[model samples]
Target: MSAPDPVRCAVIGTKTIAGQHLPVLQTLPEAEVAALCDIDAEALGETSRRFGIERTFTSVEDLQTWGEFDAVYVLVSVLAVAEVSERFIRAGIPTFLEKPPGLYSSDTERLAEAARETGTTAMVGFNRRFYTCLQAGREALLDTGDVVSVTVHADEDAGDKWFGEKFPPEVSMRWAYANSIHALDLLRYLGGEVAKVTSVVRKRRLPKPDSFSALLEYESGAVGRAIADHFGPKGSSHWYEARTASAVLTSQARSSPGDRLSSCTLERHGREPVRFGLTGLDRRLKPGFPGESRAFLRAVQTGEPVSFPAPTLDDAVRTMKMIDEITGAEEWAPKPAS
Candidate 1:
């Protein structure tokens, strides 16, 4: 059968991460940026002009009324994702939501429930799954044997600049849930659902905790460990290492944000170590922005959910469940008014 026409898409949020998404959509023949939305009128106007998008709005209400788009991408702040996504899902517009899907399990659960009832498709952005080395490593690790253990090491140097001053301290303390989730989600992506997670955190110079280490047990009998620190000097980031019965697969994140590079190394019992530069991964491997966008487009076009290299809301919710288990318990969720 022939494919469907390109989806006219609306993107909410015009910030740093959304910037990464723009070029990708421009490259995809199956999708177009039909509209743009942001609360900040200046950013909204600038992004629309820069992208040559004729439609722009400052709120979801305005976008829904006049914006003609079949799909939407929610790139708003983590705190805002739940409320924003609920609106889109209820409107029956298929959406692509960014990572740290929601800070609260309740919020994410509500989103899943709304999507199901509304018959709206929602995908969570977990871009790490598209990294070629990680993808190839996951494939080989599973093929070799049961994945016994996985270890993720990630660090950043965000310093004391988190949340600025407007947000409460509780939001600041959820640093682990906000960032290290990428590592945890990647573990679940390869090892199946997580059964349990225990975390030990240390607070240092930062407003919230400065570092955290966690141990996770997956339902597939695979165990995983995650260690993250924002207090690191610099040139610190994420890496995933998976060990199967016969071999071990490891992926290293870029040493610095200025460089777009990640390396994957595979070591078998007696074979030579294999290394791959994920920077070489194009849209085909689904590495970075384009790869993920391509994955989203596939499901949007085929009307089927993708799991291998791409993921749906179900996968994202499960990851969020695990994240809430470790970091965003009731204490982290928002409280009622007085």
Candidate 2:
């Protein structure tokens, strides 16, 4: 195929995270915001003008029923992700979806099947894997040897940002899938496959009973755990970390909506105790989004699949299974016939 012009992309949500995505998409050399879609007619017009998007719609159906964008990015609500993604994937439009593909593993099955049938590329949002910190963590594991174990922590201040409804309920619990999956997938990303998960669930900080710590037994014979809380004291650190025999790696970002300051620390112990930390990181958007979006653009333009991308739908399903076990639900397992 000939070198394609800049990938004309359409974004389907203009909410909080989508707000960040619009500007970042505008900055990518291989991307152009061809259209914007949101249920809020007012917000749609505002984002379209804000991003200089010429075409706008208040519905994904209108965008897909008669749309012409080169690719689609499904940034809709968690409950609506699979349905929206399935619409585009069956239409054979290369799609990039946001995190937590669905509240349950079953929710992702049709989209995965459709992607296979249509031969269209579909990717889930797992930007943490692309973070420079986790990127180095994977390599740093080589020196550590044996993949002993890993630990990840996430802290959120629900002080005033606590809307209590930013995320809807699955009635089966969406907190872990909503984001603990970020750290869960991170553990899997750096440590390897998971064999078993044992987690304690309880309400610690948040307005909801969604905080807990989980022990992970990796299929590679390594042990790890991750803990998250949405309500913490103001200025609490929100970061993830992993440790190896030779060194420990940590990633933390300063709290500023307008600007980003992140750092990764590696502490080594041996003949010499050396400490390495990377500072002044991009914290506004996800550290890995640019690279992730670029990979999508490459795949869209070349008609090739994204190579070893982080957090595929299947991968998210496996993580969801682990979460199910953590919640004592075990929804991923084959059930007994009624």
Q: What are the RMSD figures for all models against the true structure?
A: 3.0, 4.3
Clashing pairs in 1: 286-291
| Predicted candidate 1 versus true structure: per-residue lDDT over 168-207, tens digit per residue | 4655566555666676677777677788899876677675
Judge candidate 2 against the unseen true structure and give its global Cα lDDT, from 0 to 1.
0.69
Query: Number of clashing residue pairs in every model?
Result: 1, 0
Per-residue lDDT, model 2, residue 150, is: 77
Q: Which stretches of candidate 1 lie over 4 Å from their true place?
A: 1-3, 163-171, 253-261, 279-287, 332-338
TM-score, structure 2 vs. true? 0.84
Per-residue lDDT, model 1, residue 140, is: 69
Off by over 4 Å in 2: 1-3, 143-146, 155-163, 169-172, 203-209, 229-237, 253-261, 270-286, 329-338
Count of backbone collisions in candidate 2: 0
Best by TM-score: 1
Worst 10 residues of 2 by lDDT: 273-282
lDDT of 2 by residue, 78-156 (tens): 7778778888888889999998776666777666778889898888888766665456555765676666777766544
Instruction: State in Å the error of residue 335, model 1.
Output: 4.7
